[model samples]
Target chain A: MSEFLRFVSHQIEDFAMQVTFNPVEGTGTVVYNLSLVRVEDLEQTISVFRATCEAGVSPSSLIRILYAGEELDGFVIPQNFCGILTLCSTTLDGLLLQRGIPSNPIGGGVIEVAENIPKRFTHLIKYEYTTIDPLQVLVSQEITSVHQVMKHGNGSILGNIRECHMEAEDDVEEVLDELTEGYFTGILDLGLPNTPCLGVAVDPQYMGLAALGGTNWMAALREEGISVTMQAMKGLCDISTMEFVSQL
Target chain B: MSEFLRFVSHQIEDFAMQVTFNPVEGTGTVVYNLSLVRVEDLEQTISVFRATCEAGVSPSSLIRILYAGEELDGFVIPQNFCGILTLCSTTLDGLLLQRGIPSNPIGGGVIEVAENIPKRFTHLIKYEYTTIDPLQVLVSQEITSVHQVMKHGNGSILGNIRECHMEAEDDVEEVLDELTEGYFTGILDLGLPNTPCLGVAVDPQYMGLAALGGTNWMAALREEGISVTMQAMKGLCDISTMEFVSQL
Candidate 1:
């Protein structure tokens, strides 16, 4: 009775994603892509997206894009905004890597920057994770403000992500937390554009009990010892949906 | 025991990744970022990765650098080649989506042909999926091949792939016969690039237990039926190291 079961027969691993860019600084436009790909054969299951968002001016206009969140097409920023984003790169943790200037690039490493986080736009991002496979398939999402830069101009925008946020409701988190038997964790983030860059160390392992009910790829990963996996939302922005499905 | 186990007390889905490119005909380069985000607090985890690869007329030329991999970084071409790549993209499924196409702009989509593809190169990617919590954290990557304007550069690299005859060893079709369980499918693919773009659906019930040892996440999902995700090499060209990883 699930949408996937009714439509998709081959269960390998498939994912579809879309990203829309709202250029508030340079151009008021929305840029997004909807794509799907199969993990086993690198088959492009789907690929398409739309981006709209006009360009804006000023650093505040740039930082406002952090709210784009991966799920929404676009959002408008307050015409009157005042804030300064200390733009630069600083290694937070991990090895002396490019950004991993600190041990493990995937193990708690990041780029840090602080902006005048707006009050109305400051939405709490509570993330939840589920492993689709050991190395490749996993889903971790939430509602948060994600900021990004455009290739054209020297500015950025704040993105208000609601679709992913809605997916990770308070109830969903509760279920996953109890399912994982308390190994679940929620961190308080300060970085505006928080992204996760991780490597698939092992093959993917889908978790969850189907006979019980319909659970998604993420919900199935809990039984294993995996509670939390790093997130990297940068590669996902404005890409064709096929990109995600091909990785499955 | 394992290098990551010492401080890896808490159960976590850890990861790392590398993307390399070698443009043969025209010019090809890949740009990407690595990231890490927290599951609970979406704001905490952040990371980035940026890299590029351009195929020299041969293999080694201007800036000589040595790294990993079997074949030397210099000119090395085999009789035939094959590869198995595992990646998840927003549009791997090949859904026709209308992304904001720029009017009087530079270009759109990753369909750029550099009029070339270096002799060959392959990357193996894997991720251990979590059972619950779906997160979409990503890093964008671009692979631009500057060929001889083969078809005015607007053609798709995935339009030509048909069989697995490009490998250095066994054909992928033969490998399919080796598996009795799991599902196989070929929905989309990149012909010239030698990428499959296929899918591998699994029941998880049987595969989760057998492949994951005793800790299969599928144990939790009794029967709704699930997918056991994996990737296979597409190119006939074989690299010893890559072959080992693909078998998993």
Candidate 2:
């Protein structure tokens, strides 16, 4: 509706079609962005998890993650530890190699595309959190819907979410336990550390949920007016670290 | 149980006469220090929320607040927004002021209390989200209990829950929008922001829960082994602002 998106260098595909054919927030937003991806001929979606799991990397290097591909921006690492009395959040390689079933990273809703973003890469990307247990680091961060982000000022609530994941990966578990697990019973954005090195990558990519479950969760969220996008996590897949990243 | 309480220079008086007790923490934490009030210590219990709402001073200001007398702590800077918001947390006060009325300001059953220290002053006091919507300034925050804090941090969850006032406030339109409310659907602390501030409070005062039901909610939380505290907003109330503050 606003010319601001155009001024921001974003494309405006079917404004009338959105207003006419679709009138819902989630549906409309996804259609608009999908149109952009279609016109631009950009790779719509990529299974970063599957690619990352295939790449076998080392934990110490803390670099060269599996989902290192094009159009993928970030990732959500949810690991709960039973040993070391630590908040234990290891790298992708460590997890895939040791964690539960490689395909069930999200536990309940596997095989579906991760949803939090809407149009592909635009300006910024976000990662949203739902539940995170400290005793185990068990997580419930589903990027499958735009509702989570749009409800709060576009992608405002999730902006910090991805950052905390990327930058605070090192101190995330310990600090998360201290900052969250201890006193706070309420849940909002897991207040990960606020440091330069501690941030998440938000690539403006697309993963169509239409093929997965008739609709993409992130696209649905965008229809609700959430400002978000996808990332390039599957690009780093190098085959060796495939099993290792899943267990971490 | 441990000698940790010895250094605070304060003694729990309720242990003598009534053993004021109220078990807090559904399983985690919320604003603490306020839990220092015991169930039997009606005067102090009433004063904690009174201070938070009326004075707009956090729990850290308690030592001096008590010394300054209730009136001074209750004083506001003429239409002070914080003072107004504090006063708006009057639902519980109605129940407190009118005994024999089955209602709980601190919450239904689950109460939470976190340790209170001089340092955690700014962190340990969270009022529910009442001041919003009905008044649209800040959400009305109440002296919440452990169950309420952990289950639905912002108290917005109460929008759908009418434990005491069910059927009285029931409306078809309201219930249908429950999904969009997104208030009570996820982890209380990590879900929707209750109001304006983050529900993260840390007190280094060394004060623990004294009693529950009538005792301070803080003491109740410690027994649950939660080291942190944060309470979000919930439902609505019908009481004078001051009355609500006094009761909460």
Candidate 3:
């Protein structure tokens, strides 16, 4: 029986494009391996992958483009680039109107061969697109801030609240310095003035950086006599580790 | 600004091994890319990956092995095989004691370079290992059986249950037929007489087959007047899509 199983070798002959949306930053990053993909159908293939995300939200203006380990020219979305796109809004309909792209509803589908790529390569492409929603945010907030912090330290610190907003800012900087070490660096994006929170977006190379950053940030906030509730999105699911200041 | 972004293009260059244990089948499958690993260090890398799982549960015996794309000879555990292993139990201490290997407690770590692979290749391997406890089984069973069925049909016909044990078996066979189509396939493992349940384990190539199969099997059981509840394990976290007969 084992001898007959010699014919069962399988290879991932398919290429995949994963588009992750950072709702806090209103940005989405498109990632695909160039070596595994055919150069000819790169444009249309990306368009379809983009269409999957567009089904959920529209992408407004291209922020940055990287191709084959180099940044490309112009803000105009190129046919061959496989990097990040900073959208104007997190909503699909809003982004479509902002970008002036006709909104055609493209529902979800499974892995399929590239439209124009050679059939001989037996190349397959799968698109995994997901957006951060209110429920996910609320669950993340409860987990990172309320549950995890209380588990680490007692709630008596809440009574020792000091009006040290400046000290809290310094703590934030220190936390950022620790998180940005090595290949797992992240950027901090401040929310609107009324929101009083910070959003940190990290690259996809590291999966647990967002969770780790969020935990450290929450701990730092607690240390400064400031109370903060944070919501973290995992790198595998979302584009960033977000730290929302719920209390201060 | 775009030119200065040269520091951003970082690729994964390390090798990894992922071992997933299927509790239902009493088996564990070790997956690693042959092209990305060294021939000599394959044994050590697999040991590390296995150790990660063995850190959780021990195995009783070796079932089978496959390398590259073919199955190797004997249960002697060759140095190059990369396929599946059928174990006796899910406990790590049990497996270590059974295999007579010293228990070197290596905690979880990230990706690292292969010992002899070419540096130019820059191939990256990622390990994702998780075991499903009884709670996962309960949650999966509740979701796949109750929620999905309630969504698909009105509960009116559930009261019209018949004593069709034979029919329920036939339905199980039909559901398995649908799930086993194409590259995706599964096996049904019956529980002990006292347990009164069945476990279905599907390969990792497909994600939602267990849920699909369980839903179909439950629906079939309902038609036969045999009320059955099932839980399915997804390939993302578990080795196979497993449907456990929760209640009958």
Candidate 4:
């Protein structure tokens, strides 16, 4: 069981990971497969975990799933599918990477939002200097005002900054355009080459890109005094397999 | 004498620092006077150092003096004026500060120039991480292609980035406009609030400003194997007392 948990925690997207829990037998199976995830196994596991998903409850407020990515449309999954779920943030990162743009993570921070518009970052920690995910540290600190932002359209939420070389400027725009067409959200801003995006400085010859963090909705839950477990950037999965919370 | 040398090296602008070298006396006096500098003494010192001023020579290529600031109009003074010289870069910093804007030094870098136009930065060192001035380090590394830029309108030269809060954006713009009218030339770019200028990012709620370093010409000199000693941001001076290199 410990080994299975470890696999789930460290899983990456190219590989498929599946976990099944049976309270009656006090037994479970953890599969680390490189091929297509067995649909039967995933469906069965989803059913078991779905019982606790609280039909009609907001994914962020629900005790089980928080988001498949930053709270864009609030995707939720069964607890059993926790670590294998794909994140919208990483998916965007992946799409950019696939096009040969080297996206370098600059930092993560609490971005202040006014009238649902990201205004500026109130606190930041660079990814290069941290031992853990900076966003995770921030979310755990409970310093965010995501709840207020949601309720009043003014507050703070989690976000991150990344940079890509200016030479790929055209390609980046294309990717962003495609993502928008595909109904993707959470991208806060894209700066011009050699410019700070969302108030963060980027290195020379690179353009900064800021996005709302995938785990921001979880922060809202944590703010409301709910004990929730999150495995951020757990691993990659076929983005198609993930369903938007609205659809669920 | 060593003490005087140290004081010269560490001089700040608020205090009037004067040094008079007399080879005949085999000694020099370094004065750190907080009061207004006596004009008679300054004129006498200036005459003595003016011997090496090389009439009609570009201040950048002359061995005696570089600039009162960056090579904007190529201002040159005598070698005797080196340490006490004012810089266009710090002058802008001061103006911003006077307007209640805290201009935070971000980094020093080698900015690429194409067709006599500032393009992008090729290298950078954050000021926060270094004990020595980052520009001095880059200049000494002998990696700049400043000479090529000067000759062929393409190469690299030194520049720096500083940021000031967005709340004072109007004040900052006012200072910039005044400087431009006054023939100040070191400023390369000023970003909109929360944007990067000249390929460097600014902190949230702040705007990044990129300027040609006062010592950029020194980089050009260094590239040509001419040994140069630079006391960057050594001190401030009355802007009126200085003459444009072209005028000289």
Candidate 5:
């Protein structure tokens, strides 16, 4: 923990100011960049996660650490434990992959919403042609109006679209049902076979699906004038080590 | 025709320069904005069509005037004639309406293409929320790379998506088949029930369809440094008065 704090201090000066030794007060928070995790080095992953939390991307109340497969309630890493974490952008990809369903990551963009219903995508950048995560790019550019949507029920927010084979429709539905039952917040809309979702077109023989971007919260935080560091689809860590913000 | 010429001269100056009064050379070109046509006023529609053509939106050879319904091969309007002219954006809307298939115009966008195939949309704007036609907006902004698409089979071009009742699938397919048989260049893609046609989403129980925008030619011309004035979906006129560029 001291080493992690030292690392956070080296990376960001303000992180130390936000950290509180009291775990019960929830001032200590950790965010794992799901895309950046190195599974082979669980120790490094843990260190990075801790360092990020210490970096104070958000108030502890707003930090969200989710376990994908099974829920374990604790902040401490259990020895020999392994599990998956989910970010909204890559949650469905991970889920479908676990079920052996091939899914393709397509594009990420800003989805405009009105009265809490998605109206259309106002901007899009295709995944194939971009070097960075499109959502991250949009967020960093400060182009998203997520805070307005949250406050007024109308504005633009981050989302992503992807497609899977037509044959996986039933399986996809089943997964969606499970996610819904689990109260997942990532899903935005799913298209029929060969259809578009959220006004975006899909390839023939494939169905498009959209999810709220994982960095949406980060955008919202940034919109609120809070500083945040996000690593989207970073990598993996044991679910056992995660503590939900609510629990914290 | 003199009165129409007067109207055209008042609306644009260069249109007179392009009018060679040579039928064989195809210098006399007219484009009718299908949406702006007050069906009750056929003479006025003709006047507007002629005026727009005379405004020099395109070169004589590149001018395309499409008849939506039954074909009539003539450049003169039969007395008391009533017929439909199709712009790519309004063509499907008219066809589906004729068949009692309730269709909704959803959006207009710039679709990126690679190797003669659509990859994804780099930009989109929903129709329900905008006053101006999205394609026209994108084209007038000089943002489309249609010339590149035409020359290299990769670039961005104009397209629009719409949705219709799922029950109208057969009717829509029949219309598509007929259009295909007629060698239509407007049809871009069609989605399965409740799917998006080109990466745009549709409502539940509706299917999405997309067509190349009629303004695509204008964009291509503009990309090559041609200044073109466009009035998309402007109105309608008798199909008999239309002359295909090849026929001319």
Candidate 6:
């Protein structure tokens, strides 16, 4: 009774993340997707969610705090607030190191908290863990660098390229129609392989079409010509709002 | 200057593992491939590698223990020993619980050392860490239950299935050729969707072709019909000898 596998990616709407495992019930479940437009971004997302509840929460797992649906008490983290959010797992990294605040190492990977956070309260959400074993669902690319988006603009140089495998359905639809027609004619055929690529291979049982066909395949790779600006980071709230949106 | 994506699966000779990340150098580089044929399997792989160097050894990381190429000295773990084998990140886990011997939770996932080990020193080598991002490299399956392989025969019920993905590259070669042709015609058409399966996708740039294509893809999925009893648990030393080989 142990055979599980789940993989979700940047579902959007502020944030979303997922990675579940079973490996014959050895257990592994990591989820991240935090939000807080302001209010000092809820004290640095409750001091990085109480340093992931002091690094180890797994008594089958539970660490309360959910609003709208109800269930919110004390709401502690540098002395409380109760607008009450959704996910909560008893944030307690020793009450954010007694109060100096600094705790990130939820034991896996990703979860950066970008240099002690705070760029308008970093865009939280990025979980990490790696043992390996994710098979299908491929095709998600969003590159950038036409000389750093013509020197800065388009979200100032972006990057996101995903690829998965296991193999065989007409060579996986001829390698997803030859990497989506060679990254949409290699990013606007700048001679042949320009630099604004965009690939897609969604359909893991139509995973909301890999985020709605990667947003209409990056708007058809920016209406075919490819001068698109940003949109690449993917999840953990686009890598915690990429250094405060690449420093504006 | 960061952007690394590595995925290596089961490169055997006892075991081999790899996972390198650098989302921007927040860092992630788990690796394992220990050894110690006997001498009481190096005191239970140094008491399960000193309970993963006392649950957490990342003060910016560096444990030290390498062999053959050099580095060994004190040896530590359950005191010390020196015939010196290989890879030894300075074994510590609180000096094997201050010499009592009990350490498990090498962080990540799937690495349970189960009670006092030793079913022939439980096949040592199983690296656990699950956050999931391992893409591309799937195909390795070994299932059982043809009524438990004819009432307890083929090593009595087995398990193994591998897969990884993040996306991009002709949609990662068409979702690894439609999950390797729907897990090889769903394990070999017993009416067009049999059961016994096998899939393998290990190829972090030919890390010795995941132990030579996982032993010729489990002997060609047991001569094409699929009855593979077991042989699918490729890295981290077959998941730390799966509960000492599923309790024999």
lDDT of 1 by residue, A172-213 (tens): 334323322211111122122122111112112211110100
Between prediction 3 and prediction 4, the one with superior DockQ is: 3
Provide TM-scores for the models: 0.19, 0.20, 0.21, 0.37, 0.37, 0.23
The TM-score between candidate 4 and the true structure equals 0.37
Instruction: Give candidate 6 regions above 4 Å deviation.
Output: A1-4, A9-248, B1-5, B9-45, B48-248
Fraction of native contacts in model 5? Answer: 0.00
Docking class of 3: incorrect
Full-model lDDT, candidate 5? 0.52
How high is each candidate's interface RMSD, in Å? 14.8, 20.6, 18.0, 19.9, 19.3, 14.4
Model 1, C-alpha of A221: deviation from truth (Å): 30
- Report the C-alpha lDDT of model 4 over B1-248, residue by residue, as the tens digit: 11111221122223212322121222332111011113334433233223212210111111123332333223334433332243435444545555567668676667777887887666665554332345544555555776576567777777877888888878777776655443344677788887667766677898888887656555545454444455455433334444444354
Q: Which stretches of candidate 1 lie over 4 Å from their true place?
A: A1-89, A93-102, A107-248, B1-248
**C-alpha RMSD in Å of predicted model 6 compared with the true structure:** 22.0
CAPRI-style quality class for the chain A–B interface of candidate 2:
incorrect
Across B70-146, the per-residue lDDT of candidate 6 in tens digits comes to: 33233232323222221211111111222333223121111111231100110111223221212111112222112
Q: In model 3, which runs have C-alpha deviations exceeding 4 angstroms?
A: A1-61, A65-90, A93-248, B1-38, B57-63, B69-81, B84-248
Candidate 2's residue-wise lDDT over A1-248, tens digit each? 21111111011111211221111111111111110122111111122222211321101111122211223224332222010000011112122222221111110111111233221221111111111111011011223333333333233111111222333344434433432322111112222233211122222221111001111322343343332232211122222322222344
Model 6 steric clash total: 49
Q: Which segments of candidate 4 are over 4 A away from where they belong?
A: A1-88, B1-248
Q: Tens digits of per-residue lDDT for model 6 on A47-159?
A: 43333223211111122222233322322222222231211111111112223322221211111112222011001112222222111111122221122222232221111
Interface RMSD, Å, model 2: 20.6
Per-residue lDDT of A76 in model 1: 23
Clashes of each: 239, 133, 11, 9, 32, 49
> Residue by residue across B1-248, what tens digits does model 3's lDDT show?
11111110110001011233333343454221111123454454344323322221111112222355453332232344343332211122122223332221111111111231101101111101101112111211211222222334221110000011222344434533543332122222212222211111112221111111212322322333332222212111122322211110
Error of 5 at A217 (Å): 36
Which predicted model would earn the best lDDT? 5
